[model samples]
Target: MSDQSSDASSRPGASLESGEAAGAASGTVPEPVSEGPGRAKAAEEKPARASTRPVPAQNAGPEVPKVPAYLQAQPRPDVWLRGGHQPPPGVLTRLRPPSPPVIGPGTLWSVLATALLSALLLGDGLGANLLIVAVPAALGAFFAARSAARRLRPWTAVWAVGGLALLAIPALREAGWPVFLAVVSALALGSLALHGSRSWPGVLLGSLGLFPSVAAGARWGWRGVRVRADDSRGRVRTAVRTTAVAVVLLIVFGALFASADAAFADLLGDLTPDVSIGDSPWRAFLFAVGLVGALAAAYSAAAPVRWDGITVRPGKARNRAEWALPLIVLNLLFAAFITLQLVVLLGGYDKVLEETGLPLAEYARQGFWQLLWATVLTLLVIALALRWAPRGGPGDRTLVRSVLGALCVLTLVVVASALRRMDLYVDAFGLTRLRISVAAVELWLGVVLVLILAAGVFGARLLPRAIAVSAAAGVLAFGLVSPDGLIAEQNVQRYDADKTIDIDYLKGLSADAVPALNTLPEPLRSCALENFERDLARQEAPWYSSSWGEVRARDILEKHPAQNHGTECYSLGQESDERDGYEEDSYDPY
Candidate 1:
């Protein structure tokens, strides 16, 4: 409750209660540890014995082992740290078996409800729809943290804030696969702080597979569900089971009977309640599967399984030369690209067209994605070097650092080039949701590469965590920039300057751009509104497509009122109905 793990441990009986809950979260008996020949059997049995005892009260002082005189000068936490490189907070804690998260009725309800909502939201839905799914996830993670003896990571808070921002940004949501990748990346990094996993691989493993592992436990939950107990808790259970089976049989028969006759089926349909997961076997099966998955995640969130499969062995010497030489070569290639970019920057648009012999739009299109790929490739090279670079002579280290540093600095120029290219492209061809979203990501990744380079050069060993933190910061910053609104504003500005604009496309943009569209002038404004209204007409106010963006767009349209605008916003359906039996293809449906 205090937002710190120590407070829970301080309570009488809390540890025992936590242990019992943890056991429920897993519902598995831990295998007994085999003792070596010289080891005392009692020593091996100590933990089992301790677990059986009542938790000590706060007034009952925990005996602190006295530090040796030689070690007294060092701080308590740092006394054992001979190496200057400090591992992230939770890595050392992994030495202990992972405790279960804090789970209750609240945790179960939140998980199930959120999963149901999210399953229903499967589409191109963005804006608040993204936030709608994200908050519940963050809450589920937090609940697990609260249930366990681990405090939520400071990065978890960052994760939550960033998720909120990231989801709300309409452009990112519509960006497709990249948005999914970014979201997953954000989750993995946040869980590092959330679950207090120190290893990058462990964080990745746990976050990515949290659901699968938990869902795998569905086999455990299914144990009782599959078998009908004739004497389950005696006669009362048998009677209840019988009654339930009878009710199910009757309902099935009644539905079948009704369906045999049209009038009877119509009457039955009217009487039956509208529900999402009905008696359809497929729907029921899918719903049950989702429920199992949610329960599994909730269980793990309360008590997580540790990812010990791949243990990161420290202090293995890497071949410094093998990783080093390639980096030097790549750095030189980047230096060449950056030098060429500098000349182009100074020479302006005319020079770019003159040299390339391509028009402005074609030139802009050709360069941005190529620069983006180059930047991405450079990052991979840096990351690989960090992971595999040999630790050897001081001279090798110096050379490696200088090349990496130069690459990082040069990578910034590439980043700038990519951004300039994208800006030029967007200026020529008005902003789409994907372009806006990717531009933000490009800037963020560029920042991350810069951090990676800095860590590599400065000899700060927390490269993984720093990259994770920078990633979280980048996501948060993108949200803060309000990408959807910016794209709308910028595109509107482009329309003003160029005089050639896609009115239909602007109307097709997310509701975040609605406010910005109001600034458009004259007949263009009329056409834009007409397009928007037509699209809005096709959309129905159902839970599946519901979003704040839609709500805002509808509200804006309400004020304009088609009659006052001197233009008709007619639906394709309406036109079709008027010309009844007209060819379906006659309508564009735009």
Candidate 2:
């Protein structure tokens, strides 16, 4: 047995001899072992160290060296990683549990109040009710979310204010498109404000994601309820039981009392809301819209995703020659076009009409749409140029500014040319919805170009946000200006130029144009306002369904109602030269 032990101990790493022999290669010292009885007895007398450290298996691979605790890298507090258990080698993993939803009693009450207000005040029509619904919803969201909002920047405040201001447009104007724009823009701004999104793409994504967040909010609210079940279950049950008992008692006793007394039933009928089965679906829809919208706003404000981290990879940049060449050529092309346009504009119409062999109206219509399209395409080109242009050095930035600046200047000229064409077209023809709509769009595009030019001079980092805000402002301005009213005014003025008017066209205008159309003399006024007066007379609208424009129109029509000239106005419209058959294809601006 002694010989076998000796042989076993002779193996590498088994005894002191083998350790001493391999010390030069392994660079590690082995612990001393007792070779005799005396030494063994001494070892047993000494205190033993814990053997908590891992031991290698006999057939296992070579053990890795352990790093000292002091020398190993420490985990950083700010850094976070994501994955399940057994993460990949060299990868740091962090466990991030989703935050519990914040469904406090106040938040619940706010959501309920907003929903109730929406059901009562909205869906009658987009009138006073729109402003009424928006104000409470915004206030509810603000109160619910104010505590959790991370960075309520100045721009967020601006957006919030802008959203409320936009909602008021419906109460001010009766036009459908303007009201539609106001609602969409208000929602987008509200989304941006709730999330405190500053970066352009972040703002855009947050605004767009609001609709989908409603579903997420529902789940969040459900999870919150489940999480607090232990704390809230008894109270909820008690409240529900009390409410159920009260409702049952009220129904049974109220029915009996109503049968016993007619006066009491009449009072109850007046006190109760007149909610019919027909309106239940619509009111329910409005309530849901309000509830979900408020909850989603609060959710986003409390736990906004770090959307600024999302970056779009720019296109591979090109050298200055490659980038500047096409842009310079474009600038030259714009310059040449501008020179020609100046000739046509400055030399007066007589010379151009003679040269082109076209009528004034045809000449006006020919290039207006094309110029508008060119302006739009030029903006796209500038965007792509900025994306792909080399921006590595000061010289590169200067080059970008110079080249893009010149292009923008020339594009401004193109914008001017387009507007000029539209003016001429409007002069020859009469104003229509399409004409004014396109004109507004073209003007907005011009504003965007000017903004880009300013960004080139200042800094381009905030350009996207600036452009977005400008667009919102433009939409608000357009809605406020009341394009239909302007159309009516312009067409009425044109009636003076040629003693003929399209009374049929004016009759089709909304209540927004009533004030303008009312200025026409006698039969023409009656003919133009006949349809609007008739429509307003038919509506027995409540105060919530009344808009400023509609109310004004009603008062005006009441003071000076349309006369019974009917067929005489129609006969005059038919005989007028304004109804002369013109080719619509030639005049189609779009």
Candidate 3:
């Protein structure tokens, strides 16, 4: 059995001689074999192992290169790599939430709307007025409630209520309490509805919408109370209260105005003429009360009490140009119209001249010849100014400046003429044309110059402030040195001339009669006369018996060689008789 086992082992794997020979040839160390019973059993169960080959060594480098903590933690690139979570780039950096826009005390749209609404309501039928009130009020209330729901501040609501109250107060006085209440309610409700967005601007506009109603209500209320009050004390009290209320209303209304200055000016103009203090023992008391109330209300409403920082900045160049272009065009048109009208009146139609009994051919020829020269001279001056002046040139500036300068000359001339008419100054010329002499023309020219200057200054942007200063200076100079201390006085004269009133007649009237006729003072006598003339012209008198007859009669009498009738009525009494006779003759076939 031993001999047979030896033979089998030596046959292939189990040969000691072959193992020694392999170990000697390979020159490698062998691994130790397991000796435990468990190992011996594992070895018996193990399959024959394959020839082991030498394996190559792997690179001994770090798994990933180490990055700096600062680099890894960078906000931009790191965030980009992770996901799009970084702040956006570009001009978006400038984009931030904006603060609310501030609105002025009064808005123009609101004031205008209120004025229109008031006029329609007061001027139109009662039903229309009522309807107007209802619609606005309903809208205001709806908005107000909505605003409240939206957690808008109560200030908007207060302003709306105050505005409505103001509107209703005047209407109530004028139209009666019922109308006032209805209108007020309507305005309040409408304001509430329209301003539901809780926007200050909307509320402000809504408040403005109620201004006219308030003004009307105040006016009517004050007038009614004044008229009804028998006792001076009561009247005084009412006046005080009314004025106080009006001032309060004005202040409140003013808050809604985008421009405080404009609003104040308007308010003053509206209220000044109506203010009066009664001759009563309670006058001082009432006045005090009114003053206190007005001041308090004004303060509360944030009315600008004083003119600090009231800089009247000149508008942009574009605006100035816009104003200037129109003004220039208007002046040119006016001059043309005047020239044309004069020409026509003098001699365009022979029939017109003959019917009017005017020396049409002769006057036309002479007047046209004189006017042609004057127009040529004026045109020449304008041409020179335009050609040599700056882009918005010296000529343009001079157009306005010269106009203002002309006003000064004109005022002096007018004053001189007035003085002469009052036997204050006598002209060297023996011309009996005392009414509209060269001096009067000069005065008119001066006024035109000032207006032109104002336009130019207001139009130009570069030197707007300077221009405004110049304009203001001109205004001041005119106001102080001119016939009256206001530019309005000059305008009044122009208005009067257009109306065609007799200045002499107005000059002769008593002071008491002057106001009744809505006449200006002695300085503005021409204006009063002009207004009177317009009033007369507008009177629905028979067409043939008025100034038209006088004009015709003057023409015919002047033409008639035998009739010395033109000089027959120089005295006031004689003139009256002549006018009466002319009317009678014209009406009755006597």
Candidate 4:
């Protein structure tokens, strides 16, 4: 027995094995030894401590501490564990989930003030009230951003001015839908600009995710209000108290005075707000919209999403020959098309007309929409080519810039061709709203292509924002020009020159066209102005809801009232109601 014990103690790792065996028998956790140079010394010292403890019966091991089952179900620890190992202390508590952002008093006041302003200024239908409400809303956003301690980007000033200009469109135009779209876009741009969003994806999200952000802002604002409610010293609480007191005083005193005298009651009736119970829901809706919009802007400004941090993987670049070949082929095609256009423009149209046996109007109509679509497709092609273009060296960049720049220049020519065709078509078959709107779109597209070419010359870092700005500018220009009015003026001029007019088509125009329509001959004038005058007779817009366009149309109609001559005007039947076949031709691939 002594020899066997001596043999066991003489074995390698004998101390560590005995210590671990002792720990297992005792059910006491063994201390971990330090790795490296200290490990041998620790192993040597461990058995001395183990030997001093009294040996226990196998079944009489020390009691393991009772951990509750709920406590046993702790979070998964980061480090791997061997059999019988416990996680380090406080691991579970350290891994608790973080809380969301806390909204504050300044943000709360900005939201409340903006909501109240919206309730007072924007009742229902838009007018100068749009501009009035916009000013306060913008001011709210400015102050909110300031309160959040966010620095406004220099670009924000441009968007602020642009938003104000877009809001002015509602006051100037009688058209509702266009103005509505402009206002929505303007708001989106303003919100995005507040955050200094730079990427295409960011711009798209800022525009499309606007309502979702509003809801998020509302929740954030509610959290702020709740948090502030707990603190008596909060400014929000003080403001609420003051407002409640003021409301009580006004209700008590105003009622006593209103009941005291009939004259005072009449004066009270005049001085009292015109809001009705029926308008309460709508006004509340507007108030919420204002609150959410301002909150969205402020929240975004404070904690703007790092959208530019998203990395876009460029398409696999082809070798020079592989990349250059397709682009060269495309450039040749564009050159060929441009050559044909130049031929037509340089007075070779006569020969083409003789060969096709079609009149100038037919020739122009057949090709205008096609050219417009081709120009759009060319832009897509250029975008793809740039995406995959080789950037291996200066030679590659030069090749890309040369080829894409040529493509853009050719596209501009195509734009001009499309516009020329529209002009010819309009001259032959009088200008209509569709023709004018398409012309505007084509013009704006031309502007975009020019911008692209400029981007290629300079760095393209700002290309997305520049394109967005151009689109905003185009919409603003389109709205301010009043296409309906322009259409009326152009058609009237065409009628004078060619003794032809689409009076039926003209009759459907809005009151913005009244000044131009009023210049027509007696029966035509009365016929065209019939709807305009009737609308004016029915309109009872209050001062806040009255637009500049409506005011002008009313004055014009009052000066030259319609003679109720639509029946006689219809009998003339000199103008064709078929308008133009552009819609049918739009589907034609050619």
- Model 1 TM-score, 2 decimals: 0.60
Full-model lDDT for every candidate: 0.59, 0.75, 0.35, 0.75
Provide the global lDDT of candidate 3 against the true structure. Answer: 0.35
Work out how many backbone clashes candidate 3 has: 45
Distance (Å) between predicted and true CA of 299, model 1? 2.2
Give per-residue CA lDDT, model 3, range 1-590, as digits (tens): 78975695576333322333344334432332457776555444332221232211221122343577678885655655657567664331232112111211122122223333433333322333334343333343333234223343554454345344343322212223223334444444333333332332333343233332233323432443354454356656876799899999977776666265877667665433222344332444433433232222212122111111223333333333543454455455545655555575477456555666644323333333343334334434543443343336566565655543343333333333233332211111111222223333334444444444454556523232232223323322322222211122333353455422234443333122222223343333334334334443444322211222223323332343121223322331212222211331333111
Write down the TM-score of every candidate. Answer: 0.60, 0.77, 0.21, 0.78
Cα deviation at 80, candidate 3, in Å, is 52
**Ten consecutive residues with minimal summed lDDT in candidate 2?**
89-98
Error of 3 at 2 (Å): 64
In candidate 3, stretches whose alpha carbon ends up further than 4 angstroms from where it belongs are: 1-289, 292-449, 457-590
Q: What local lDDT score does residue 167 receive in model 1, on the 0 to 100 scale?
A: 53
The TM-score measured for candidate 2 stands at 0.77
Distance from true location, Cα of 508 in model 3, Å = 9.9
Better candidate number, 2 or 3, judged by TM-score: 2
Higher-ranked by TM-score: 2 or 4: 4
